[model samples]
Target: MPTFTAAAHGGPVKTVLVGRAHNELVYHGDVLNTTARIQAQCNALGSQLLISEVLYQQLEPQPAGQFARRGQLVLRDKA
Candidate 1:
């Protein structure tokens, strides 16, 4: 999974996946959360294995959407 940078109020964190990158790992995260009722409604279907949008876009010879659509991850807005 491509680790995307997140700019916290203090500064940018190298490991925090945010924006499009966070979207990539979320499907994996869903593996655990899917058992609970609430997460199923909010996350991608358990079958949609995905990579980061940046890499997916660079995936040439094939269309990017083969893996996942751009900006498909539904992240809760930061408070």
Candidate 2:
């Protein structure tokens, strides 16, 4: 998994896969919350992996160069 920086958290965090387990190290509250937020951000930005749009607009040369046109995406949100 990639360690994407969250502007809200102000550091790097890695997302882990989720599974049915009741161990602290195997599955903890903080770990689960962070991963959820990262997934939401990635989905909102329409990328497989992503940072916030705020961060993207501030790049020197603009990291947008690294992304290719994957075509327009349509997302469904719960009401």
Candidate 3:
């Protein structure tokens, strides 16, 4: 079975084009990196989805049992 992971964050990002043809559009910024790092943790955490605290806080209140706290994770390239 194929497993998937997800993470979210709200912030600005810098967009740029790279490669010899300069046709590849890329999103570059801390927000993107942070989200990716969080997504990567899904395998280790054994969860289908992992969301960042910032995104969780931005969400509307949910049922008491809807979301479980997984605690803080020390992501790569982050202090």
RMSD of each: 13.7, 9.3, 2.1
lDDT on C-alpha atoms for all candidate structures: 0.36, 0.45, 0.87
lDDT of 1 by residue, 46-74 (tens): 43233434344454668544544435545
Residues 1-79 of candidate 3: C-alpha lDDT, one tens digit per residue: 9756788777889999999999999998889988989988888888888888888888999999888898989898889
Full-model lDDT, candidate 2: 0.45
**Top model number, TM-score:** 3
Instruction: Spell out the clash pairs found in candidate 1.
Output: none
- State every prediction's TM-score relative to the real structure: 0.28, 0.30, 0.80
User: Clashing pairs in model 3?
Assistant: none
Off by over 4 Å in 2: 1-26, 51-79
- What's the distance in Å from true for residue 41, model 1? 11
- By lDDT, rank the candidates, best first: 3, 2, 1
Q: Could you tell me how far off, in angstroms, the CA of residue 17 lies in candidate 3 after the best superposition?
A: 6.1
Angstrom error at residue 31, model 3: 0.5
Write down the worst ten-residue block by lDDT for model 2: 70-79
**Cα lDDT for residue 74, candidate 2:** 36
